[model samples]
Target: MDVIIARHCVAAGEDGLSPLQRDLIEHPARIRIAEAPTGAGKSYAFQRALRDRGHRILFIVPTRRLAQNLANGLSNDLQDAGWSRQKAAQSVAIWSSDQTAVLRSQGVASINGVRLLQMTDLGSFDGGMIVATPEVVSGLLIRRRVEAGQAGEGVFDMLEQFDHIVFDEFHSIEARGFGLAALFARLATVQLDNRVGFGVSRISFLSATPLDLKPTLVDIGIPEEAIALLRERIVPDGRPLHGDVRLSLVDSPSLYDLVLDHLNEVVEELAAGRQVVIVYNRLVDLEKDLPALSRKLPEAGIDPARVLVINSVRDSTAKGRHQGGFAIGRQRDPLAYDLILATASVEMGVTFRNADFMLMEPGFEAMSFLQRYGRAARRGANGRVIVRIEEQRKPWLRAVVDWVRERPGERSTIAALTQVLSRSVQAEFSPHNTASTFGQLSSQAKWCTALYWSVLLEHASNRQPRRGHLLAHQPKGAGAFYRLEQRVRQLADEPGLTEQVNHWLKLFHAQAFDLRTIEPKIRVVSDTGEAYDYPRVWLQRETEVFERGIETGDEIHIQGGLDDYWREDKDRHAKRDWICHFPHTTRTLRLPCDERLVNRWCDELEDIDPYEFDWEDHPQALEAVQKLVRLTGLVPGHDPEISLDAVSGVL
Candidate 1:
């Protein structure tokens, strides 16, 4: 549908645009690249664009969690504000990733209407912000949805009518595939298919750490000056729920013990302050020891109400088949639990409006650490993030961790990934890494591979994004080359080469510090079937407290030791203990549902000896069930007449 053909296409009523929204309208970019921090009121930019006279708008992201959250948020905000013309029953639709043809034939799979889509269904929404993952957008532009006949709408045509496209978590783009994001940025800068192609009227990229995307931005066409002006200074944190984040270096310390100690402190604080608490990124290198991880929390005086654990695996599950938000989503509540432990999932889509404290592992992944840190310090409340690491992991950690950390140099992973994606866009193509690497991949596989490639490729490049650093003495008339040379010379004259690198390193560090890598926002919706008064679960993060913290100016780097007995002691109970509540893949039970809808509910309980599926409830099958139950357990007088014992004699 064309913008001219809309049932109503007039900018009507008073939708007073915010200051930033005004900037979006005034300086609308042919290749506009805009970035604002978490609380900087970024959503206003899109709301302004909603008034555009375009046939459609496309909103892209890196994760399904983000897509769902944005869908719900946009719909809720729109309805509450009365811009929503949707029928009550058709308020909005959450497009799931499980809409297979089989499910569609059953009338449950669909892509139209207000939707939540995987990276492959970007074409469903012809003229609205079709919230999607980068993978889906990439597929829309670079590949076909399915083969011919087994057809669906192609985003190719749909991409044309878009007035402006938005990439919210631009920095945390897919590691395995960010073809859509990079392509969008690259084309947002240059026009290929007239306005229909990549320009999409105007493209805006957003993220907490928008700096990490500087190279990609410049490569696209965002003026270096604008990039600087948009991302000026790091906003000082609001008051933290936790005290000053104390990042400490623990050499060869037990990772479990350190986390346990940290968790204990948060629990204590929650109990005392009666505050909801949160722990960010607790799954890294801690999942194994994390199960027994909580056994000692009670010893530290923490209650379950004071703790809520979340991570990425749950996001994967909720992507399909599951509709709960416990594992992932932005949870902000002042009156819920007392402690909140989380992975990167809390940053995008979810807003932490009341949190004010955070504990983070220390490393050079500055933007990420900051985003997680920002979760606590919203609503003008003070907040802090303490980045810590086991000192023992430093040597190997620096080798492994630092290798993958985003840097400011041209050759860094962020740059390379951007360039490769940019070139793919220029050529209008996407990668085939999945088909080549196809296998039963653990959910972690995509991220690990993308991380490794970023380290390996970007570290070898020479491109660099312009940072807000200048030379001590350089003529105003000097070109970029002369200024850069002068700056390098002055730095060379510093105390050491390290000090010289320090200048650029400072800006580079700031870039990484501001990269917007994030876990997709999640919704922890609890299902109650058809019951109206069931206990409801909204994503409300409990506050947490940690002991001993790092002052703002403390050495913001973490050193660790790795020469310890890192064991992978696998145990049976370990499966569900520390990790996510992943359904048992190896087990399957068949349940019949209404023919129109087939739902699989896994009652993992294999069989209860005391009770049977129908041993007593259905007398016909009672004898056979009783006989089978006897092999497992035996009892006397209380036993049914068709008991396996008596059935043995009958046989």
Candidate 2:
């Protein structure tokens, strides 16, 4: 079943990945789960899992941006130790949406760059290790071929074509729409028979905090032996490491400015030739700020191309290694980029390992806080992280601070993360403590928690979701409708469908339902009209209270911004961040009305008759609120200008 992929990797001749990673790879199990603390050498563990398990390999990551780093790491580090060229071609392959149709149609090479050619244009390749985002791999798993030879059936047939699969960030598996991860979970149980009968699926699930996975793994049917191998149960978190790291509060009145100042210093250092990683909580800030950040670095003597910025927004936009753009001018050493600014992309792979200092943007969740900080000290070097929380955000950041202060071990970040997940981390576990990710104490001896861990181990070791599945997103709660209308009115100009818009108002008089779902409400009180009636705070977009951040459903933390002028300022700056009720297509949005943007938005929407668009087949425009959010990143709140009832019919 295992096919020798191709000769591509160039060994760095380094000692190897960290100890934890080494243990992960050497494990003989065809499938396993491995948990490491925040900094417990999981990335290195991923490599060994890929190497010893034959040549064919696949790595899945939670973020598209992280896939590149995974690709880079696998290329340099995946050596046979003492094997022939033909013996070493099967560790990894990278398949991203960005790969041009032609390149994907023709076989593409692994990072080592040996285009072995495919059996067909698409399926089955020998020995190649693949790096893929969740969706792309989902498309591949259902197919009969890949970078190497043709595939048959059964889990072994699937496993035969590939030596192993690993996923990074195992805790992220979820369901929002038909994500690759969700599909894999569904199939792993039903099709693969809990990954047992078919010896083909050797896997490992890895995570810093594997708490949330207990329920997911339990849902699937797996046994105890498999479960024990899933999570190694390494060190316990919260043991208290005697480190010199300290947390500082930034009481800067101008919080944004303060963040910029700190960011610039890091950038200056990067320009001065020190590699660094910068993590922020929200993608919106990174989106609007990165271009400016990149612009500022060159003046400080940093090469713009050297710096890489990774975020959810960027992941949605990354075009893969097609057309071979950089195939020629490959640099001998890393370039001089002052720093790599990222959202959650810093959470994986070898990319951030070269640096030991970190600066985190404020107002992020506690678990994420730990993950970002973990990016800094790794590979046996002592590192420190500096945090700058806002004056008002102190209360919320306390959980994260306490977790860090607990100190599981001086170097055992994985343990610290475990304690946080077990105690400090603010997460909603459906089946509380009775069920752990390692093994379940449920009535059914099937061991669902271990199964979940098995999935994570496979994912962690593969650095890829099983069969290239993506981490799923949970379904979010929608808000009231009337408020959604008001938000739409404020953000967008009077749309072209005023007639239908008026017709929607008539429904108010004949009110059929007393609120079908939690969609926000919107009433059309004219500019000169009197105050309207709607629910008090019906789905207000989560605010940055202290200007720290503002994501949809993030909880609006207004600092008396609504006392008096708040009424007039309702629509003002609201479009800059927004909340959408739909799942992934329209999950979360940032609002702040921009007349310039609206004008541009209108121009884009004017020609797009939502009536003529097919959301399933095409992603044209999201002018009408009902249009599936496939076109835009996420759906915005209701548009009072355009009625929801009317949008339902037209879209």
Candidate 3:
């Protein structure tokens, strides 16, 4: 079968398109769900199809590194399809925040016309390829809908222009991205149908672990036929043969000891002239452990320079060492360094083929475990994997680890693995009501949604759009839409939550609109409601107080007992009609101080700049601030920057 397919497509690898990719091209689906194990050449499947079909493609990935990797990989594929290397480079665009240096350092930017893209640049991105993080695309969709104008229309049109959009690492998508992707797929169906008088647009979701897209797409209002099409299009490929790969677990009381043992083993391997990849889940952990390990390596008779640490926060050197930005794969030459130290940033999509030895701090989820181990044994390389697990994770993660250890050479089908993971997560988090649980939402999704909705509510409140706005997409029902509306209302009605929401909104909008020149005063409000008087003038920075013998940052609860000190301060600082009741430490009682002070402290927190606020500066003042802020409601005023919005045409 492989030989037959390879005969058909001259450009395909010796193994040719996996049966999944082959089926996709032969019988295309409006919404395709394809599955293939890691190192099964998933990247080139769509790359080949789009290049041959001459279709514009939008490739969405989970991380900036993967974006860079896919951009370069696709460019090479384009060149292979008779495009000059320079022409291929010029035809592709990459969009991500603050990744220019990483791109240039990696030579992703050196290719002729490859440009760094932004939300605004989406309008002018008439290139053949687009590589971006799903988060960026989701934000653009939200911004376009809320801030409807020429800019909004431009984004809508740009999205509609894509012939195919591929979501790589589909299992990594959270609720918000999943919702947005499903939404875009629906819109593309309409736009493409209108343009060609039929459904020409194709949406493909590729993942090694299967996800049930029916519920998610249906939740987002995708049509029944589309959902059916997705089910039919699901091409679940068998796992690749991982030769000579052995999986073993190390258990120790202290994680430090576990890592130390692994390092000792790695040093021994390095001394034997074997290549190794050591992956850490946390960059901070790697930074802490690397220094200690490097100090010990000299005694072991191995050059410390042979160790390469790849993290986003490191500095870039000429040899691509200390390169702190997004690394698609092992930045340093695999042959050069006996070991490559990396964080989870390398886990998802990056390929480290030559390194046959892997020391991993096993991640909690099943997909992570698979992807991490999949890094080794690439392109027919035989490898071994060692997972160091802490005592705490032993109880829950042990079963999952055991599952992997039992199947070293054999790979489980995605559907089987998905079932295993679903059970594990359900047992841990939502045993009783697993069906109704808020489906696998990432922290980014929650934060982004909260911020986006706050911006929308604030803008809509000011503009006073028609009562039946597009926001109420669902008829009154107990479903995802109802939950979404409930969340929106909570943001709109609650003061403290609204302020927190606005805080996030302001940061994102600043990036979207380049807000350094604009004053944040309009949207930024004091959490304690005391940053301004009735006229809303910025207050003087209040210095926190620390008395002798008191810790510098203890939280002090104010009882509002009306002592002489309280009376004096109240008389002097309290504003008229501002004695709104804030809750006591216990919500059962009210603290009758000037609510503005507490509100301002909580909302804008003008009294203490969070980033600059020092716990050691004054413990008493820190406690005082927390007591004041905590004495009240769950949310704050979503102060809309009406003037700023009108001027910038974006909220």
Candidate 4:
């Protein structure tokens, strides 16, 4: 059965602009948001709006690959629209810390013909477009704020240089602390309040799976009328943008088994010289399946050189061993490979030409599903997507499976599927909780921002010599910039203000900065003294359970000389290594929620009363607790007030 995933029909309004584009160009609000499905020309709309303004622009994306792609694309668009090649190349620049060393050595680097600029260059840059990730922006803001006096640049001074700042893939802001979304909220608040600032730049957020940011904005004191939201509406005469995509859902207990079952088809596609993309949810599953496929491919007369693998490891040295195929360290053209096996690394922003996709069910998020599906049948090419739905006991997964089973042969738009899943799966489990989660996350972000502002205020007052230790404290936050400014003044005269701030910084960093709770990765040393790091969670399973008894810094050996450890890193080191080696077969041990691990992880902050910390206000921190509980069972001897149930209720 074939299902047509339609794109929204966008008609041109005044000046040959779609309604969404027109609003983006003419809307009076200082802050604007555009919500449209993939391939609805959202990028083109923003490009036209920004081009007309001719303002110094800072375009922020979620990934380095995306920043590179957009920088090159923007340059081409400019040249095609009557600008000279030199002018177009000069107008667009990519700002990435990874390219810093290269830029310093060569003065400049080029990505697909667009210039890559050094971070310091931004201080002197007068105009044109600069593309960067959110982390770079946050780092710059923090560095400038901390070193204002000596650096001769304040946070406001840095921001005022840009006439417009656009955050692409704005949905990523829902991440815990100091994430892009929270930073946007804080900046929006500051701009709208007309605080002591100069050359205020308009901010825009673009996302296909847009969040309802209104509630979060209102909570931070922005008025409803001040924010403008432009959504792409379905038109009766609209046509599909990327032709039609045929979606087939297969019920399977294991995605690995499902892939093995379809090995013949995969080989047939490769033999016919058609591109194939298989997406796994974890590296462990990919590692297991690669060797099996590699062994069978030669028997089927397929060359091992046809398989390319990509994962989280971005080091060139780590990926150099895959001479038979290739790994994506520096960007390689996707068309060069006949078969590509990837994790979530390529799930967003990366485009592939005319490929058939096989994807493991990527949890309950509609955004993940939509993004992965968008990779295939791009432009006007028709495509097919085969999704392996593992049997799960969760209510949402059951509902999704039943829904797909019932909809056989019924054609539906991508937008319709998204809406249904958002309501059925996401809403059922945590509809209202999503906004609440972000609000709580934003508050923690606000506190971090407030701390940074307080430091700047202290230095500006000229009351005392600046403490170097205080400067070392990096503040991060999401909302309430005005309130944060107010707090800065209120704390100025207080004795021991620096000490109190430092104390809170330690606590916040412990709770918010720990990445293990979010992604639970482990490091392992191979039999040949090679080390590789990968996520501990099993990809074939549906839950968040992790393998137990594999403590960090444990040395183990692989049976057959690390034949295909694609993530092998010789020079790359970690403070601790987690597992002895990959188990011979899959293990079902749940990550024990032992109090010992929590204490060991956050030993320094154990003295502080968890009860006094207001866990209810910081949903991001609460989420960490929930994750800990989910991974390890309920912690033994844990403080009852801070138990999983308590934290879950707050969330």
Q: Which number leads on TM-score? A: 4
Model 4 whole-model lDDT (C-alpha atoms):
0.52
Q: What is the descending TM-score order?
A: 4, 3, 2, 1
lDDT (Cα, tens digit) per residue for candidate 4, span 1-651: 235565335566656566776676567676787776666666666567546666577788877667766777777788788888877776677767555545566764332122212322432433477888765565454322233233433344435666667877776663233333433444444432445223466677887766656555555445566678777675644433465677777776666677677778877777666777888876656665666766665676667666667766422222344523345453554556777777776665665545755545564455666667767766556667778776554554455556666777676776666665555444543357432111123333344333334333344322232233223222233223334323433332345444543333223222322211334444444444445544443211321112222243433334333343333323232122111100011111122233354334333232234543433444443344333322222122212213333322211
- TM match of model 1 to true structure: 0.47
RMSD to truth, every model: 25.0, 16.3, 14.5, 10.3
Q: In model 1, what lDDT does residue 482 have?
A: 30
Candidate 2, 296-318: lDDT as tens digits: 65565565556665554233333
Once fitted onto the true fold, the runs of candidate 2 whose alpha carbons sit more than 4 angstroms away are 1-23, 26-31, 49-55, 78-91, 100-127, 141-156, 177-196, 229-247, 253-256, 259-273, 287-306, 312-336, 348-350, 392-396, 401-418, 434-651
Weakest lDDT window of 10 consecutive positions for candidate 3: 1-10
lDDT of 3 by residue, 328-408 (tens): 232343344566777766666876536767878877565676677777765544556777776576433766655655665
Residue-pair clashes per prediction, in order, are 62, 103, 33, 7
TM-score of each: 0.47, 0.53, 0.59, 0.68
Across 366-474, the per-residue lDDT of candidate 1 in tens digits comes to 4454455445544444333434555445333343234334332212222222232223222322232211111111222222222222221222121222011111111
For candidate 4, list the clashing residue pairs, or say none.
445-477, 445-478, 553-577, 591-632, 592-632, 593-632, 593-633
Weakest lDDT window of 10 consecutive positions for candidate 4? 579-588
lDDT of each: 0.37, 0.41, 0.47, 0.52
